[model samples]
Target: MIADEIREQIDAIGIERGRPLLISDADEVLFAFMAGLESYLQGEGLSFDFSSFAITGNVKDADGMALDREAVRSHLGVFFERHTEALDPVEHAAETLAELSKEAQIIVLSNIPLAQRGARARALARHGMDYPLIANEGAKGPAVRLLHDRAAAPAVFIDDIPHNHASVRDHAEDVHRLHFVADTRLARLIPQAEHCHARADTWLEARPIIERHLFGG
Candidate 1:
């Protein structure tokens, strides 16, 4: 089961006691996935509708007809396979996380395919975010709980998806949740989640908010 696999991966990471844990999502948190993906799609003569958050319905060909679900999925796979290690870091993500890492244990919880995990790790390392990366699938509630169980109290979860934030809220209510969406246009489209402590589009604004919650600064 996915939950068992995630638990094994978390246990293998060997959490440090007496330190706060920061579980962050990679796409739109540490790296610009939507932006990079858009560029990649453009190259393939396809584009997004920008009106919907879901990719399958949003991705369209030059004729403006939405691509089939399978085609969209295939395009995503190809995009990740070829461009996983070449993504641009979200603004101030590396610097802010590096500062936070001094006081907290940082772990990247991404929903990328397992095959691209190596490339994602290499990319983060290249961007000076050499932290432990965990590639997961489906809802992140169970995995977040496992990580929280191993770390000190007052853990923080940073992600762009409201569902993931809600999952953490349901599974680990004590953990602080930060809803981060890096793309300005996309951020405007997303409503603030009731469970999130704060919703931010840039790390500059996010850093202070997270610091206050985690360190009481």
Candidate 2:
């Protein structure tokens, strides 16, 4: 759900009434998160085993021992803290959003820690995505719902996580959801989320769908 302060942030965004809305996830969808994490893990003498969609269970030490959830979380914390401002963007993600922003009020609804929100925004701005960002903590359903309600327009939600799609569907039944995994390697391992309207592996394939959904053909 959303905390009071986070709710305030979402409300503070200047969403034009009747303008289309695009709510996007930062990592994996906009930034090359998994790739950056894998490289960081290598530096820490650990490796990311892309066996499944789970990050915690897939990380292994040099001895090939799986890291516990807490350890994995710690690594992720350090990874984001140290590398948030430097991670590369997914191909064409910024360009596509910029094009979409001509008609849509865009907001990055990433699951990053609130403390790193400014760093993430600065990094995104560096890549030409200067939209307002909401650093969310838990399920994105309620936040997506709030954004949708405020915009009062056809909204599109792009994310790589299936659970977030389900959460948005549950909280905001009308928001169009597209499951987008920009990393080809990660896309090969994940199935299309049932709750999502479509699965787009790259921004190339996703842009048209969002345009068609928000602006119509």
Candidate 3:
């Protein structure tokens, strides 16, 4: 399932080869996605409940009622379309990744719609994260596996979603998983996944851990 998706995207963008691959997620891990989404929602006269980890059920109206799943999905599309290029980078993400790139091949694996790929790439590059960006959908296990196959061991995976971490854990067991969420408020709301090597809210904390895991420092 993910092989076909990976083949399609990799064929389009082409992959770079290097030792010790770092497959990372853009939202939450590198960019402040939930924070941007919340601000976008506020502009639309909506806001998140922040009480729940999931977005679909947590997005609320002025009357404090959750929007239907379809509505939330539609709003997400609009949010990305309007704000993807301008979303702020998570603290220390650009600097840490720039440093880490010297030691490992850094590839951003984001679960964003394919249409926003160019915009996202441009945005990341503008923020000094000019690494390869792969826009994918659904579970990231197969994609991570394929990426790992291209580079030397040990592959590292970083994402905010537990399900994505679980996917890598199941399909690419050797890949080190780092569960990261940039927003402090939302970070506290999320529970750490058992499959992850470490759960971090900032790149400052995660950089040392990842460096140690991959470089044996």
Q: In order, what lDDT does every prediction score?
A: 0.89, 0.91, 0.87
In the order shown, what is each candidate's alpha-carbon RMSD? Answer: 1.2, 0.9, 1.5
Residues 1-217, model 2: lDDT tens digits: 5799888897788778889999999999999998999899999999988889879789999899999999998988999899999999999998988888888889999999888898999999999999999999888999999899888999999889999999999999999999998878888899999899998988889988999999996
Lowest lDDT 10-residue stretch of candidate 1: 1-10
lDDT score, residue 208, model 2?
A: 89
* Runs in model 1 lying further than 4 Å from the true structure: none
> How do all the candidates rank in terms of TM-score, highest first?
2, 1, 3
| Candidate 1 per-residue lDDT over residues 76-177, each given as its tens digit | 999999999999999899999989989989999999998999999999999999999898998788888888887856688998888898888988888999
For candidate 3, write residues 1-217 as lDDT tens digits: 6657566776664556547778899998888888899899999999899897889889999999999999999999998898999999998999999999887888899989889989999999999999888888899998888888767577789999999988998888989899998888888887898789888888888988889877888
TM-score of each: 0.96, 0.98, 0.95
Model 1, position 164: C-alpha lDDT score: 90
- The Cα RMSD of model 2 versus the native structure comes to 0.9
**TM-score: model 1 vs. ground truth:** 0.96
lDDT of 2 at 202: 89
What lDDT, from 0 to 1, does candidate 3 have?
A: 0.87
